[model samples]
Target: MPEKQRLTPTVYVSVDIEADGPIPGPYSMVSLGAVTAGWHDADGFRRADGKQGFYRELRPISEQWDPQALAVSGLDRTALLRDGTDPAAAMRAFTDWVERLRTGPDGRRYRPVMVGYPAPYDWLFLSWYLVRFTGGSPFGHSGCLDVKTLYAARAGVPLASVGKRSMARGLLPDLPHTHHALDDAREQAVLFANVWEWDGVSRSG
Candidate 1:
């Protein structure tokens, strides 16, 4: 019998986006950030050392914006209008970054999977922007892994009940929730790895 080839390892890319409103088109994704959380194979999940990342502040395509949403990121729209990368250029760079991740820094070929906390909100914006600007997404039309849903299933809890506050402390690193896209993505990468490795059994008495 011939030997079988091993499946490509799964690489998790944690992503976070800061937007100017509720949705794309009428609004804008002011900033996009991402990092290679880790990879899983026959040896199991291993964290990325000196993780690779991508971040860009985008020029707004529409004038519409929500004050509360903009306030959360604390990013100035005026400054972005003046200096941010063009949306199309930014998306192209993002696509290139994702392609690079297919060959990890460790020299192993990997299958990159887009990961988001709850997923829907971030995914919606990312997908729309990628298609609108770059014409396609590196992760495909519907490819994504939701961290919140992953934990919910692992912990045997309701989807609506999962939140960082309810998660085990050790599962989350002592990183600040800066609301900055890159900072948040880095923190999320660690969280994704920790949760992925957790047994999900409650250790409480």
Candidate 2:
């Protein structure tokens, strides 16, 4: 990559997870997904390639898997059994992949931020899961950016006003179906891009 093509400091890991309900510890994480992006992708705000990192899926802990949550995510125990990787292994792989992006090929540290639509909800489950599985988050629990809060703040409105339906109607080309973790994460990313474009976000430093 050329000097101008070098990656920026602002990297985003947009995440989503399906659960039994609002509560964190008691409820369980059913399915989790995340897409990585960078500040250059901020709605054509500047010159940047907006390169994509990668997506990850982790195996759920047997005790943490909930039947009701499976109903919501439509993912059966059989599927998880066959496809999921162990939680600790998954976290190690995920953090390793993340570190690669945050650092240069030669190994410089990068502190890419994490982003989520309804942040605290997803982060609560993820943080707990990471701590339980790995003892701590590699990102150090810093920079948990909330898209809903960003939308609310930019629109000068409350969260209720920026409801998914309203946001889909006003900004997105289509509404995202909830419960599907990967799809939801992608939809939130799209929504964020659209909002950034509309709001004319200039600098994301």
Candidate 3:
């Protein structure tokens, strides 16, 4: 008889991005943050005891930026221009951090999965920068997990109707929605862990 194969755990990293415009390339991913929310395998879910993460602020790749977008994050573009890390350096550090997380202390490899609130927006900027500066994306093209979609599917609700406001109060994390990149990332990390452990039914139901 053939032996059963063991499955590798999936390490969920919650990601958030603060950009100067709606898209990448023409705009820029001004700041980004990622927190290791948890890991899951056959044994089920386990949340991280403490926030394990990475954050970087990058010098703008282009001068073009949407003022409205900057205002949303409350980050000063002028300050970033003067103090942000070089794009290449920031991407390199991010890559290294991701690699470390994927390779656990026991030397076994876990699949690194990027989780985000909406995902599309953050994934676009992070993927673009990773490819542009690091030659490839660590999360790859399909490794993203959108919390919004997860909630919609679990709650049996339409995607359009699954905003945070629509979620049950108990399902929501207590963290504040600070626009600061790292702060938001940590908040999203808590939300992701909660959603992951949910039994696909509302607590009140």
In the range 10-111, model 2's lDDT, one tens digit per residue, is 556667787655655555566677666445422223212224434445455545555665687777667666786676776666667666667533344446
Candidate 1: tens digits of C-alpha lDDT, residues 1-205: 3223565577788999999999999999999999988887666688875258899999999989998998999999999999999999999999998888888656888887889887899999999999999899988876799999998888889989889889866787789999999899998888888788888886311
Q: Which ten residues in a row have the lowest lDDT in candidate 3?
A: 1-10
Which residue runs of candidate 3 sit more than 4 Å off their true CA positions?
1-6, 105-107, 202-205
Name the runs in model 1 displaced over 4 angstroms.
1-6, 202-205
Rank all candidate structures by their TM-score, best first, as comma-separated numbers. 3, 1, 2
Of the candidates numbered 2 and 3, which has the greater lDDT value? 3
How much lDDT does each candidate structure score?
A: 0.87, 0.63, 0.86
Instruction: Give candidate 2's error at residue 63 in angstroms.
Output: 4.2
Q: Candidate 2 — what's its lDDT?
A: 0.63
lDDT of 1: 0.87
How does each model score on TM-score? 0.93, 0.73, 0.94
Better of 1 and 3 by TM-score: 3
How accurate locally is residue 107 in candidate 1, as Cα lDDT from 0 to 100?
Answer: 82
